[model samples]
Target: MIKNGYRNDCFVASVLLTLYANFGELGGVEKLFRRIGDKDITAWNSMILAGARPGHGSSHSMQLLQELCQTTLLQIESATWVAVLKSCENESDLVAAFVDIEWKDDSSWSSIIGTYKQNDMELEALGLCNCKEMLNEGVNFTSYSLPLCFSACSQLSAICEGKQLHVLAIKSGYNRDVYVGSSIIDMYAKCGNIEESENVFSEQLEPNEVIFNAMICGYAHHGKAQQAIEVFSKLEKNCVAPNHVTFLALMSACSHAGYVEETLHLFTLMLDKYKIKPKSEYYSSLVDAYGRAGRLEEAYQIVQKDGSESAWRTLLGACRNHNNTEIGEKSAMKMIEMNPSDHAPYVLLSNIYNAEGKWEEAIKCREKMAKIHVKKDPGNSWLV
Candidate 1:
């Protein structure tokens, strides 16, 4: 849109810059802003915001913010201040450098709190929260920012801090807020407080698919497959259609519990009922589940049907475990045909032969690999 010479309207250009920045196309955003010729404070604010958004590296954003501070003669606005503060929060070194700078309002405080939270500096985030409370200075922190602080505490497994943040959130009437509630549930779950996670989920005014997925993943990851399945069932009862992540969680639960029959059922349902095609991870899990159960034929069939290198590799791993040379050779051959340059199959095949005390065969395989120039690269261990 900026390419068509529509840079006259600052508001339109600001919106465009925001969109580009959100999408990580910062270069395009800079091009448009520079073409405006007479850059306004709003344009500068937009550029700062574009740079400070999460997932955008803080170093580059900080550099641009410093340049703006040096070059611009205009008074710095609150928005620009917030963006720069946020960049500082994202990087701890910057936070220490900017700590003495006086922030005019709660937004700037929130930005600092969010940065500490995002960087997993739990104590720092909690300390700032306490400072806000001590000020009692009538600055109402935004509902959105507190959850990030709680998330930090959760990451650190600081349950006490997380609970304090939870109380603050409720007192501030943000308990029922979907985003806040989801973060709280996730925090509790991540901290291994499953009961607290459930309590938070139950209290939510409107739990979305994301919240449901979080709970499901939490249960699956913690080896509570039955609980994960129950949560998934409830999600379905609530009319929340499962997405790709939903299936992945379900597969994880099944794989963990070695519920081969259930895994097969869910895999079929994912394709036929939900119309969700299997991803590489899903296929790999299927192969792993079957292979672990000593069902080599079933594992091979899955790899053949999926045609994924990961799936084939899973079968090869199983063959190694069971000492099934016949199937192992077939799997290795198939893998080489699919990706001849990959050194994994050759190494795995050679290992399989060595395990069987077939040293001659192993040497022959190594000779064949050398002829094909398929040498193992340093630091590329097959185990990982």
Candidate 2:
């Protein structure tokens, strides 16, 4: 349609551009965007939206925003700002883009706070909960806002802050909202307040998969394998089918508590009963269970079959944990084969040799790292 001089029709071309972007076909959007000569606000917004799609990040959208500002006399609008804000991949960039908005609406404010929590900038997310500008603008908290606020509080272990949010959630009558309920459960569990988490879980009139998953994950984090599995059983009894995330949390709980048999059984059940394809995280947890049990051979077989670098790294870490020199050497070699430029395999292999008191082998591993020009990262730790 665009090829038959429709590109000259700015309205038609812009519609085509918006349609392409809506379908996540950035290539078509780019082609349509370039063909238009004198673009208006709608055309610019469509181009910006396309750039904001996944894989392109915010680079293209930000570039277009700057170009629109410098060259075009048209003022940037709210939709454009929101598109750029949504494109931001990290907390700092998200903050910068958000502050560029001429007017902060409820949706834009929600995006900013949600971005903070999504990026794991918990302290910042918590701080955003009290933004004076947003408060002055009468931007009220919604169901979406409560979850991230609770998540940040949970992560920072700000029990006082969490309590405040809990009060707000109840007073606003959103406490029973399934997503809010799940977030509350997650926050309490993460803050080492499992009792509070359980209370919230029990209060749910009808829990969804998310609520069940959160409770199971809470138990897993607390190393309460019995409780986690028991929750899974409850979910099954309630006829709430488990998803991939559910299985991941369940397997992790069993792995951490050394329930190797249960871990394997759950993995089998996930494939045969639920028909969930094994994601890398799932395979990694299963491999970790075997590795933690010092079953190096089984771990190796699983990682190789799974074909994930992170899973292989887990197996390698397990080798170091159990001091299995032979399997550690094999894992190290395979990791190097997979990613020659990565420093992890070299560092892990060298540590394994050092742990076993094989000084020569350790020195050789370091030499190989040096030869490959993959500098080992400096040792660092935080006082948590």
Candidate 3:
């Protein structure tokens, strides 16, 4: 086409750019992009999507959008931002894109709202959720939207709002939905309404593993470990086969209660009786259990055997909590060796030195971090 002088056409060039980029020909895309005299939103969007692929700068899409926003009169659409979100690594950035969208459908709203609530932006999530325009537009209030809103209220401990939603659920007939029912249980428990959570649990009909998991996890979170154990025992009696998540919740209960013997017994049953493999997260949880119980050596040995970065970090944090400098230093060194680029182990190791008043050692650790250019991320705290 270029040989036939179709290269003079911006539309053809833009289409060629997209095709080439989609075919993994970045070079061809760049060539066609350069030949186009005037790049418009379509051409820019294609280029941004291409750059957002793996092994490319994840921020390139955002950079292109910024350029387009400054240069073009074209209105940004839902597709454009959704494409940008494909490359977003953090929820905060997603929120940045989300707030700019002038209009969206149910799926878009549900997706962003759920994501916002997940990233601890309950306030922002709920704000959009209750946006009067959305309500006026007659957005569907199905199971999807209700759970996240309830979750936000629960997380914020907004019991009055949660009850309001429960009322809404009853009126809307969403309370019977399994997903909504589970979220309702979780919300009640999170908001410290144990009685309400229990009532919801008892009222559930033909509940699945997820609902049972929610109830057990809620009990575990509230320090009612024995109750959690009782719930686990009831699973078999109810003829519901427990998944690994069920055992994780049950093990977490034992761990929280400092029932070391019981925790170990459950771990064995999870493997031999239930035929479940101990994932890295389960190992980390086990390490946490021992660490919290002042059983440092046991935790350290388990972490050492597991050899997962997260497990080692968990053990290291436990050492820090217990003020066990020796284990902390060792764990920190191992973690740094495993992933030299991460700032967490470096910061924690330096803190361990500082905490022990080893000024020279602390200075050395700090210097190493500086030399490696590993900048510790600033800490963030969320109210809800």
Candidate 4:
């Protein structure tokens, strides 16, 4: 009693399966598949896409696909196979195995290349890039695939390859695309070409918030705190209201410069002026700023205000720096109470006792740690 008078029942079943899959009702889709008796190629594709979509599915979606490929001996469409391969890139062994599998078309090759890039398998990604040239099959690289390859070049710090990709992006008319533009900026930043990053940012036809955030982070990460702050000022003047990420970049800059007053001012602005509630990361940065400046009391006060374990740990670290046994003991107790398995506070407390010449107390602390199997992290000096 189907109303549409659709002659092909399999087509109707496939449409319903796709609907269920898209809505994440996989069990319902499976039930429909079972009722349909003989599932067609479209039905199988619908099921495959269901598992490949971002959330509410297993990472083993690709394995399921491989199983399907073997059982049916069916020629999987390029789009379906590409989705499965993209999922496998996260597994290095799988990527290596699948590289030998026959692809449907050039798009499939681009997909595999992009997958390798996304997974940080730069060598594999580069190999695919070289393979495309060797074949000389006139493969048309899509906008989606080019950014990913550019990302791999960025990670490898291959300035030459990155520049070539930028030129390709311009030629493909994707230079103004937000995703492509962001990748270009990130590549320049990673290659230590801040001027190039800035130039790209300036030429962006419609720079999105992500592009601005990347620029800000690049300056902050390279110790150009002043430049980071200047970017924020420009963002404000341009009337692009700052988001959470914008504040994070600003806070990072403040933290690196040890500008306590400015840090406090920005922190307040985030909460009051901007009306953005401070996230745990924001609080942690504030604690780090106060701690590094040897303002243990200020660090302690921030933790007291926001009762987060991460904030407490930051305060405890500051206590260790100042060797404030009293505050250290309190912070350690609080941290342990928050999460007993945390080893940091115990080690910090023991160090505090050792600094105060309380060897017996330190030894007792060590023994307690031994009973709980807590181990201290190896100490390494940070130059900056």
TM-score of 2: 0.74
TM-score of each: 0.69, 0.74, 0.64, 0.73
Q: Write the per-residue lDDT of candidate 1 for residues 1-384, one digit (tens) a residue.
A: 556667967888888899998888989988888887677778888887887777665665666656665676555555665566565544454554345343335665676676556555677777666735535756664665767776777778878878877887888788787778778887888888988888888786667788888788778768788888888888888888888888788887887788888788888988998899789989988887788888999888888888888888989988988888999999999999999999988888899999999999999999999998988987766794
Clashing pairs in 2: none
List the candidate 1 regions with Cα displacement exceeding 4 Å.
1-42, 45-93, 96-101, 104-143, 150-160, 334-343, 363-384
Q: Give lDDT tens digits, candidate 2, residues 317-340.
A: 999899889988888888899999
Each candidate's lDDT (Cα)? 0.78, 0.85, 0.79, 0.75
Q: Write the per-residue lDDT of candidate 4 for residues 1-384, one digit (tens) a residue.
A: 135544247788878877887787888876776676565677776666666666543455555566665666555554555556544435554455455454334565665676666556787786567534624655656667777777888778888888877877787788888878888888888899999999998997666677788898878768787888888888777777789998888897888688787788889988898899998888888988988898888788888888898888888888887888988999999998988777888888899898889999889888887888877777798888
- In candidate 1, position 341 carries an lDDT of 93
Task: Rank the models by TM-score, top first.
Answer: 2, 4, 1, 3
lDDT of 2 at 326: 91
Better of 2 and 3 by lDDT: 2
Ranking by lDDT: 2, 3, 1, 4
Model 2, runs deviating above 4 Å: 1-112, 115-124, 131-139, 381-384
Error of 2 at 311 (Å): 2.2
- The predicted structure with the larger lDDT, 1 or 3, is 3
Residue pairs that clash (backbone atoms under 3 angstroms), model 4: none
- Minimum summed lDDT over a 10-residue window in model 1 is located at 96-105
lDDT of 2: 0.85
